[model samples]
Target: MDDKSLVLPGAIFALFSIAMIWPPDEFVSAGATFEHLFYRWIGDFSLNIVEYQLRKILVNRVCVACLPALFSLYIILNVPPTALSTFVATAGLASMIMGLAYAFYTISTNFSQTRQVKELALYGGDVHRLMTEITQEYLEFANFAVSFAHSSREVVGSHWLIHITRFDFTIVNLTDVVFEVVRSATVDLNIERPNDQLQFLIIEAKIPHKNIKSFRFRVRTDQFRDLQDRVAAPIGMARNVILHQSLNERFVKAFVSCIDKNPRAVYSRLGELEPCFGCSSEIPNVKIEKRCTSIIEGARECRQCFCRPMWCVGCLGRIFAAKQEQERPDIWLDGQATCPTCRAEFCMLDVAFVVAEESQLDGNF
Candidate 1:
């Protein structure tokens, strides 16, 4: 092939290398990009240490071999047997030889070591079974959940089972969690205000080997409360894990506090209360009544919502959150959002938690 034709292939190879090494969020969301590219040689599963290591080694060797070969091919094709071309060709050839020798040495030394001997022996038993079972709960771009027979927990990243455990047959237990550290820093430093919306909940616990292991979960900024009603196994084992100082939990608490401070309304009859329009399961217990002093022109100010109690506290909190500037969560508490039913502008102070008073019917009737 001509030297000009090599430009496209070289660019493609560079991108492929980047994706393999430090994959972008997009590539990870695509699912098994690295494995799919080298499926023939690397195989599909990297569940265990042996498979993972072998795939790594194979990919490294291929890259090492291909890089020098491309360099040599370019020089050979472009330059016609000149002294410079000969020297370049020789250098490329020698480079490939050195790379091959290094690959051979690495492979030979790795195979001789018995570090993974125990792991290899236990792969077919409980190790493989745990990974296989956890794999079913794996969701790309979503929270990684590894559910065990006794407990279910959310992992930091997608490859936690393969990377962290390395198929050691260790059952991850966070039952004795002493404390959870919540981390929240501005994702974009250029922004003046520190965005509390972007946060991570970290839980540190001792794994099988008594080694301190930390599992981090990315907090969902959009949702005030974590959705526990998933199709996967119940993760109630770590239910209280995010309750301590989590930004999401803090948002919910702040919203509820605001609702409590607002003017409370009581219904004479319990029959007037209806199910929340957002989530049909819960009864609407909150009414939007303009209690804020802010009076701005247009639909920017807090206005009374003539609509009935059509939203529960949880649903109203979520709606309030959705209207605020996601990038600037600092102004979320003071932001105004339109009511879902009447489109009347309302702020956090306008939402009131309603209590229904039941009236007893006299027997004399």
Candidate 2:
């Protein structure tokens, strides 16, 4: 979840309460109590839903983040000023109560969506249409920075595909090229949750292509290339979308703008708003989607854009491996791990492939 969204509600509630209390207003004490009660209620709600194991999570969030805020109040109220530890403990307790409520809020919101999807699906309603409506009305009506996709994973829930957006598909496939070179990234989601819905969404065109499609790539937390050195392409935030075949047409148009400029151009130059941080050996290629989007260009070039795979089906491409993908040429080679077509020397990662002959050392060891 984006930090901004998570904090918005609480910030609003806190500020509103403060506004009423300022300048010795009529509601100062009431407003303070209201603020406390509101947050505490949210904390309680979250705690109420927590299972035996997940309860710890609620406590941790309260103690680590929420408690500090409350302790500030404690320092101001204590006679002769209590010890820092006293303040800390009181704040922690207060924050825990508030955090519990927030957790409960989250659980309720998630559960509401799950129920909505289940009820809608049972009636044979269209998941995509519902997703579009919810995203437009509830998710990103004002915040273009936000986008949503409908996705479901077999783990932890039923066929719930409703997720808020920030998806991108085209850039992901391009990134996969680098991932394959790094020798990391095992396509486990494909094997484990074959039917999970995954969509890539891009917000307004900060990078020129609006309505970018979700990066319909599988998450492979297991595979790690150069694990010892932490040398691999940056993994930007990617949500788990239920595996889907087709994406929205508006989404397609946005992605389409980023594709080949020339008939010969294979790979698409998809861009991203949120790139990874701290690592610089490899550039943030911001990947793309393939399966959900049509590949006017052939395999090697097409796969460079994050080509999403179909349900229970996968492209045995080299994006996850060092070997040449049998079906497609290495158009997706924009990673730090030099591509097979390296003779072009800085061929610009998003450009079409220039197939080079296999060169081997004079003698094999």
Candidate 3:
């Protein structure tokens, strides 16, 4: 075959390498496809075991690195010995060597059976206990990270903290560790509202013999309170760090609490209510009606929203919060916000539950 024939195999190999490292949504979402292709041999191995997961990761990497090399070698053997074939052979050999070296390094650092000294360095005095904790029952691996009840394998543990990446796994003691929450600069405008951005919890630990010093873990604003209750160590009072609630999130809670006290708006049971426009996962259970005494009290009159009930309470709360002055959060509830579907203005007092059937209110509503 001509040198031009190499194009197909080369392109295929390149795509394979990319997919192995950064798999597309189909590979991730389709569990059967992902398991059959990647973990076909090791599918039966218990994910709870740290050793099994480490071995799985190491095997995956080796495969990722060596598969391309094997493809290159196949091309060299099939095609005539040209300069292109010679170059392919050289690249194949290099790839094999790199993969083997990485495998060896991983075995030495992560595997206790291979290198006892590294294990001692990792666990120190609690070697036996910590080793047992890690190996016995870890949660299912989520992208090389495990999730326990309070902490994750990639973040905090009861006594230890671990950071697992594609290439490295670093673990450190929780002793003398400092935690700080900071605002994340990277914002997904499509996913998050303009005012409510993301935040991350930084875990800085003192590792004696490790190059890694800190790990950044994502913490959702709504789950912060629960996290605080679960975490043993108090968050550090450091400069430029905040563990307080995001304005939008705080407003959501308050909005829900206030609107819950208001009377329910009766909708016709004949009409089928659709899923929320803001978050499609939930049913539209809220309506914007002028039930508040603001109009009688001589405040800004709240117009009755003629739009259909198309928003959940949580989503409506979010929209209401997002429309308010971001800087003036104190006056947020007292202020008015225009309905997302209709331009009619309404306050938190006007938000009400949509009850189609009075009987369903006790159970599903």
Candidate 4:
């Protein structure tokens, strides 16, 4: 549906049209008469065909040898065994050679876009599945904890309720036993979980005996802010939670490292920083000059994680576009965006461009 999708098909149609309307006499009388005038035009036209075929072969290497062989056979069958046949055969052979050469180049290009689509589907599915599982697990855990809290109140002679809050998943409690349970859950969820599904639960609870009436505990995730929006309860109650932690450190790291390692991190103690986490050559402070202005100019970050570099607008746009295409087959909502690093939901409009200001440049220097 996009302009890029139409490119190859449109080119094929134009080539087919040209070939259909091509006069047979033009081929036969190519060098027979008006050698000076027709010769250059014929040569140019033949070169154009060769170039076009070569380009096509670059896109699909499978067609390289096959197309040339088929065309060679056609030429051999059509042309009589005569002096003129030699010239036509030579032209056909030349086209075939060019096709073969370009075919070798196809390996480097993304000739099969289907591979990218498949990868996107798998990546999106895996993230979604992980998020669903984590949420379910958290819900179950919260229910158990709440029940334990109520039962403990009867034994302790003090009323205690877990009041879960935002960000850190902090849990407030009157008893040391409950505090330990909550702390263990937070650590396990944040640090011990799979690198790809790293997340923390935000919980709040009341300390019945103390002046400090409430306490909070947070299980940290890679994109805590993003998860906060997706997983939080409607009434800010822990039991009424909905966990949706789609983005994780591993996914973001893979995506960022897919193209290149962060140059800054490569030399620094950071080793290899994730570009999806807002580390890249394009960041103005990095002092690295990139040739692609679109990438450099379009850099943006999640507002929730202000200092951390998130993604170039172009890259994020493609990701958002791909997700939209995958989810809503009929309609695309361009404005919607979710940070893979912090799991924050935001509109495309909220993405701020990285502009190199005079003061900032001076500060960097």
Candidate 5:
């Protein structure tokens, strides 16, 4: 038998046994004691019920529930001794009626809005809306960048496309003279639980080409805020950086060394080839001289200002460090950094390392 079934009968039998087994003289005193205890239990139960009803009324603001509760309280306070039992029973019945009525009202309201509830469940409600808004904003930024890149024919060398995803961005360099080079890189904005804040992940890097690698960095709120401010403002001068061959070589060496030490950090194994804007090398080459890395690692580049002289992570890091030294040499502070070529503010952490080919990393070997 279920516990409830056994427990219910057991309780009843115990109460009956207690009543039947008492001695005659002691029975009278026992009856008085039992009556007192029963009244006390009833009072406690009634108080708890009243407390629950009041809390329900406050939380739900159900006018129907409030009226019955208030009437019950009034009857309890004013009803004469002769009619106390009847009034108490009436109050309890009112409370029950009100509870049922409130439940019915809630059920009917939910049924009426079934379509809306279903839609919200399917589409993720607020989360979906947030994603849509972010996508639209990024699209507008990309269009503006593309337009600017086209207008400044001399400074900009390639057409770029920025693909917006839910949590990351894929930037593809679309300008290739001979054939379309699938040279692309990904910057992951790691939006954690609650999705309010974000971190950066470099999923792919193509410029100043080195092996594909991943690097993580922390993002500051002010730096994020600066990026947002730029998008909101009128499109201004597109920043372009042209890196010399000597500097490019130095950066490539640093990148290769880092990759050698941390082989697992290189996430992509794509064997794609693209002429480095800085060193004129087909990236992901065994030779560091031929590999080129993109200028802005984590930040999306403006298509109009995306030009040659791309630098690897090491070069960019040096430049950033130098700028910091020049600005505030004594006090160390990690704040917003801008592209040397374009003067556009970006989160350094979001910059990714690039590999020439992505398919090779698919475990074919």
Candidate 6:
């Protein structure tokens, strides 16, 4: 695949904007210059002077150079079946005559225009939105691969000690306009032990497959911070994009639709809730936590405690014994419920008392 590039559209937009404002043929043809120029030059002096800035060297500088640069770009973007023919012919015409003349001025003064031509030579110079997109992609790739080994992390196997790696980025093939391939990179992932300086390493970068024409890339960290940052993050995002699983407008609407109805699940979306299905049950259509919101966060107890159903009979029996103990002047802890994780005993009756007390506050207020 081609590497990403951003030359074509920028060149086209910039050139075309210049062309539409230029003076006509009679004014541009050397001898018939200025005061005898086309009617359009009369109103916009700034626009007129801009067209003639390089005219001393090339009389039809803006017209001959910019128009074809633009029209070639148009053919590149418009991409009609016969558009390639237009671009090849127009680019050839633009290059031979005034191309060098305009390019010399562009390079000597504001050189961005000259670089665009170089990018065209690499990426086929057709106006395309893809140029910007591909450039952004290469930048993102560089942000990861540039620092492949040395970010910071705890080397888990070595007694949970912290360590940082050192690395550097190098570009290999800026020549390939289509794909900005970094041919070599060096990374050092270990801390220097006294005089035992850590050795730097060159990663054999393996881009899976690419198709790029022109791209601008920036150097970024090659060292990784964590396992997910190194491995899972990139693959997961790519997989989601490939699967068409973006959380866009349609997904948002569906999520809102689910939230409004109040389903049995705390969160309407799958995978959002932190749950233990081993502790959950389907008790007909009974909803849990109708009265107390606190139940959602910590109260692992289910429908029985909420509704005081048959299963809660075991708890009620324990509470009854404790109540009897209170009447007989004997100290006793309230109904005990065992926590499954820690096997710790909790006073279920005390929890019920707190819930009842909180509910009473609402009435008093």
Better of 1 and 5 by lDDT: 1
Over 4 Å off in model 6, which ranges? 1-121, 125-130, 135-199, 203-365
Ten contiguous residues minimizing lDDT sum, candidate 6: 155-164
Stretches > 4 Å off in candidate 3: 1-9, 31-48, 97-110, 113-122, 125-128, 135-155, 180-183, 191-193, 196-216, 220-229, 234-248, 256-365
Could you give candidate 6's per-residue lDDT for residues 29-93 as a string of tens digits? 64344233433433332332212222322323444454456445545565443544554646646
Cα RMSD of all models vs. native, in order, equals: 10.5, 21.5, 11.3, 29.0, 26.1, 25.5
TM-score of 5: 0.18
Give the distance in Å from residue 344's predicted Cα in candidate 1 to where it truly belongs. 8.5
Model 1 whole-model lDDT (C-alpha atoms): 0.54
Please rank every candidate by lDDT, starting with the best. 3, 1, 4, 5, 6, 2
What TM-score does each of the candidates earn? Answer: 0.45, 0.20, 0.53, 0.19, 0.18, 0.19
- Residue 115, candidate 1: alpha-carbon lDDT: 35
- Kindly list the per-residue Cα lDDT of model 3 for residues 102-159, writing each as its tens digit: 8787667655543332644554566656556654433423112333232234545455
Clashes, model 1:
0
Point to the candidate with the largest TM-score.
Answer: 3
Q: Enumerate clash totals for all models, in the order shown.
A: 0, 51, 0, 26, 27, 21
Instruction: Indicate whether candidate 1 or candidate 2 has the larger TM-score.
Output: 1
lDDT of 2 by residue, 1-365 (tens): 23233245446646654443331344444543233434543353222321211232333344444544554454445323436445555665676677767767747775344333344444346655644443333222121121112221111111112222111112111212222221222232344444333343321211123232332222222211112124233533335323233212222232233323311222233232222222222323322332223323433333333332111101111222233342332332322222232221111223321111223112221
Per-residue lDDT of candidate 1, residues 296-357 (tens digit): 55447666777778887877887788887777777788778899888988877788776654
Flag regions of model 1 displaced more than 4 Å. 1-16, 23-33, 36-132, 139-190, 194-253, 263-296, 300-319, 326-334, 338-350, 354-365
- The 0-to-1 C-alpha lDDT of every candidate, in the order given, reads 0.54, 0.31, 0.64, 0.36, 0.35, 0.31
* RMSD to native, candidate 4: 29.0
What are the runs in model 4 whose C-alpha is more than 4 Å off? 1-209, 214-245, 259-365
Q: Is candidate 1 or 3 superior in TM-score?
A: 3
Question: Across residues 246-349, which tens digit of lDDT does each residue of candidate 4 receive?
Answer: 33333334433422322221112122335442323222222112222222123343334333444553355445555543434223333344556565654433
Residue 33 in candidate 1, Cα distance off native in Å: 4.8
Flag regions of model 2 displaced more than 4 Å. 1-82, 104-321, 324-365
- Among all windows of 10 consecutive residues in model 2, the one with the lowest summed lDDT is 308-317
At residue 315, candidate 6 shows an lDDT of: 29
